[model samples]
Target: MAQDADDAVDCGMTVGLYGRLRPYPWTGGEGGADDGGEELRERLVNLALSRAEAYDWYAPAGLRMRGGRSAHPVPDRWFLCDQGGADWTVGEDETGPARELLWMRADLPRRIASARLPLLPMTRTASDALHRAGDFRLAALRAHLPLHVTAGEADGDWEDMRDWFSLAAPAPTVTVRCAVAVSGEETTPPAWRSGGTAAEVGAVWQTLLGEAVTVAPGAPPATSAAGGGVRYRPYLEPARPVAAYRCRVREWTADAAVWLLETAGEALRRTGHRVPVELTAALA
Candidate 1:
């Protein structure tokens, strides 16, 4: 297994830890022009951009893979791409083979049940319907903004216009959590199979809720001409936005138990932006 140091070398780990590990820190305060959530978001954007530049696959194709890569360099653009579509499998029940669209560790169901988090069983088709309906309804609420784009291409100009943003009638927020024991084995859930074994599958949960933070034209501070904003707007399909709050691992073993939080103290201290709340939903 890769140690924390080794994992830190991976592209995903770096993107995920970007702003949260900076020296200046973002502690949610009032000071020079470099304090607050806007700065925090900008810091994250810069870090992500650097990583994206380093990795070739992380461009348009990687962005499109699995509905675009998470922790993208351009915050607004990544946000739009993610919020653009709810990609799902259609008519899989009758003809398509049983698929693992979004599989959680088997044990996760029980843990979440005990923790008392809301959950909804989702199929790919069902998730897509929710995504489509949600986007359509949200656009209608603010029809003046022209947020909706053509089927194939994105709404280029209006993509960064935050003035026309609106919330959904029924915003669904599904959070999934699962625990799996690590073993040195090849057989396990795909997510864990590569580096470790799934000794045990723990409880999992999924639910929907309303309330999210979105970027706007003037809301988030503007970027300098040095970093092109070409990547700061929605350029994908099925715009569905989801936020992440917290994701960590708790290891329980014979000798000791440990809880590893995924944030760097320096980053949070500098920006004053408490880590974002864990906000995520399944695409079914």
Candidate 2:
């Protein structure tokens, strides 16, 4: 299940913490199953509240705590998160006996995003391999891709930096502008592509951009698309035109190129475009 969650993260899917609560068995204890439902519900609610409190520092702005029975009839799944304005009460499931079982969920993306960080999905296997090989620098580099870090901040000490990276908190205010071209023609970037279909690419882009991307018909020349021509600039809104932003982008791009070559070499090679070694190195 943890691996499944990690895979979802790697695939850029939003995941939430989930758990189930049920009444204690009626083994002639102090409180029987019939009477224990409400107690169990309270305990579960308290547990959720405690977790929310513990993670409060990482919670997103405008976060509101909520709990309640789901409206759906089949397989009731309740949801709770550190963010959003949905407030629900602890109630009984519709299909089954009142308050027999309950479920709760808490989203992770909200907390991460609230900290102004990018979601760089990684698999457990890859993480484990990097740890075993003691490639902490590369691991840290890949972990915070599209985000720049100072030399003394995160790169100096891997052991201490690991904890900071794990929390994904206090991230630098930086935005990633991806320029991807495939098959020597102007097409969607690799990050947005799943099976190279227009619909799939557009959907992914829309999800990331929070708006539809305008795609012009007809293909441009190969010379124009030689090195991932400027498709679109996906940047953070309310951006300031400061020199620090440019420097951070230059640093991040150099590191990202190296990381992609080292980690996603095969994937990049399959795209049929020559790797921009000069471009990546020029920034360095």
Candidate 3:
């Protein structure tokens, strides 16, 4: 029988530690099946909480539902990270079960309002490829980002940023902005290539981005679709994280892009403009 996607709760909270999305474990893999459902959930929650402990410096250790009302919000597939050797937890309180995971939210204000297009390589570790890239791109676009009317500290204000951008353009729109796809040239790569780590990948990506910008400093011809040839593909990592397991391919679209296109596309669809950018960078 085919395996399920795993019982996990994907809370797409645009503000919490996970920064718009967080998942909790619920079921063990094929080998780690549990007969007790609630017990299993509690176990996952404890695991996530344990992982959150490392992030004591980032934010609150974990997430807390206003009243701890969710019965079982844990997911099955556990996302693990090796940064400071982190892990997640599911634990029981006098009332019931709760789940939490570790993440950094210091850059959230910059995240919500700016445009970010990231090409991420899936790995065996837990450091979020999206968040890491998103934070960088947010910084890049901040100067050009449309400013809010009622602005306070631009770094920490999420609601005001969202509201201001909403007035400018409404539907969710995320342009690829810029992309770098990586590929290996070897006829047969190693079974589990360990030449680098997540931090290393982030560094290399930033370096290359700096190079690309330097290479194309001047604006491209007016006819150019993605200004100065904005769309690019680099040799990213392989499709499989290992020899047999396929790694997920992720694309980081600009948050503002997602919001802008969302509203414009819907309106244009009625008139049959049929925007084409939506289908170009589908994140594999």
Question: Which has the greatest TM-score?
Answer: 2
Candidate number with the higher TM-score (1 or 2): 2
Clashing pairs in 2: 67-88
Q: What is the clash tally of candidate 3?
A: 44
Which regions of candidate 1 deviate over 4 angstroms? 1-36, 60-284
When summed lDDT is taken over every stretch of 10 residues in candidate 1, the lowest stretch is 136-145
Q: For candidate 1, write residues 1-284 as lDDT tens digits.
A: 43332112111000110000111323331232343534433443344334433442123222222244322222112111111211112231223222211111101111111211111111111222222222111100000011111012212312221121223222433222211111112223232333211111111111011022211111111211011111112211212222122222121111000111111111111222122111111111
> What does candidate 1 score on TM?
0.19
lDDT of 2 by residue, 197-231 (tens): 33333333332222111221122223321222122
Regions of candidate 3 where Cα sits further than 4 Å from its true position: 1-128, 133-135, 138-226, 233-253, 273-284
lDDT of each: 0.19, 0.24, 0.24
lDDT of 3: 0.24
Deviation (Å) of 161 in candidate 2: 9.8
Query: Candidates 1 and 3: which is better by lDDT?
Result: 3
Which run of 10 residues does model 2 get worst, by summed lDDT? 238-247
Model 1, C-alpha of 179: deviation from truth (Å)? 5.6
Superposed by TM-score, candidate 1 places the C-alpha of residue 56 at a distance from the truth, in angstroms, of: 2.1
